[model samples]
Target: MAVIHRAELRPTKLELLAAWLPGRRWYQGHADADVVRVAAYRFDDPAGAVGIETMLVSAGDGPVHQVPLTYRDAPLDGGDDWLIGTVEHSVLGQRWVYDACGDPVYVAALAGVILTGGGQAEEFLEVDGRLEPRETPTLVSGSGSEGADVPGISEILRVIEDDPTLVVTDSVQLAVVRRLDGGNRLPGAALTGTWNGQPNPMPLAYVSTR
Candidate 1:
């Protein structure tokens, strides 16, 4: 379960992304355009120290984007390459934010979800010193691993394409799909999850063995 804080965040999420999105190679919108958050989901970290979130946003009239982010109380080691920047949380103080792809905690949590039939983190909003169950507009579930010691590198598909290029071999297992088509079923997903409003399961990430 994940606790949702109703408190304020300095520089807000969108504000941070607005300044950073333009530099991303995969971002397809005008970086200066006002970004609108469309939907989001979360995955829980077992240790409860890291906050993992994936936000879907739209800049102006462009296509929706999937941005996975991880929040930490301290700076992540060797994460400057993927760091989105930092933010101040009213309840948690200073937080170090980074692209989820570079965080081991986020990667492991996602792998755990795929290996174990796990659902998206349950959200409870804190209100007036009380906790209230909040319904996530989008629900996600993962495909569990079969009884096998599968090892691979988990890859995030930055660009959504019509035909996803995935190659799963004895030494590699790839899962890739960004723009999900409800009609097409993903292949060789160690884990497959569905969005609440969509009829199909979207490939969360691809795991490739080394």
Candidate 2:
């Protein structure tokens, strides 16, 4: 079937980020910036229920960053508590952007995967007003069979740029995998492409260490 769970050009979550990103630790500045939805793509889930969307939100803050986020169908236990916002779906008609990981069905599915892979689903949630990594609260599941492992940020990294995807997994994102082809340094673990067609995967940090 289609790999994307929910594929459509609907209203993006840009408006929400206008007030969210600046508050994040990763946000650069602009004090009060606005988010513009550029391009968005959804990943195909083994199931047909859960919603996993990858959005490219751009702010007027000079450079842009690819913010990959995961959305679910079920109502997250915490609602917008941890999520950006919740509202009726524009294209799907009426629904909310639930952070699937919060649902019990999804939790169970993730637990099942980890159980078989010798790992556990750790919910990196905000506790005491601070985002921290904690053990899975309970068993979680998905709305439908649309449950699958979330990809690390590295997947966005063009393999033609760096070496094998970096095994980095502590930051909730995968490192770039592919090959470097120039003298510049790669910025983050993931990069979109070169500005002037310099080198694709220049170096994330210094240059060639992979």
Give each model's clash number.
8, 26
- Write model 2 residue lDDT over 1-210, tens digit each, in one string: 113223233444676567666765445548566776654333334465665543445677534443434565555554454476554554455445533323333333332332233222233444454556543222222211224343322211211212223322222322321222333344422233322233332222111112
- Clash pairs for candidate 1: 141-193, 143-192, 152-208, 152-209, 153-208, 172-209, 173-207, 175-206
TM-score of 2: 0.44
lDDT of 2: 0.38
Report the error of model 2 at residue 122, Å.
30
Q: What is the TM-score of each candidate against the true structure?
A: 0.79, 0.44
Scored by TM-score, the top model is: 1
Listed per candidate, the RMSD to the true structure in angstroms reads: 4.6, 15.0
| lDDT of every predicted structure (CA atoms) | 0.68, 0.38
Model 2: how far residue 185 lies from native, Å: 7.6
How many Å off is the CA of 120 in candidate 1? 0.4
Q: Cα deviation of 161 in candidate 2 (Å)?
A: 25
- Candidate 1 lDDT, 27-104, residue by residue in tens: 667768998887788999989999999887778877666677899999988778778888999999999888776676
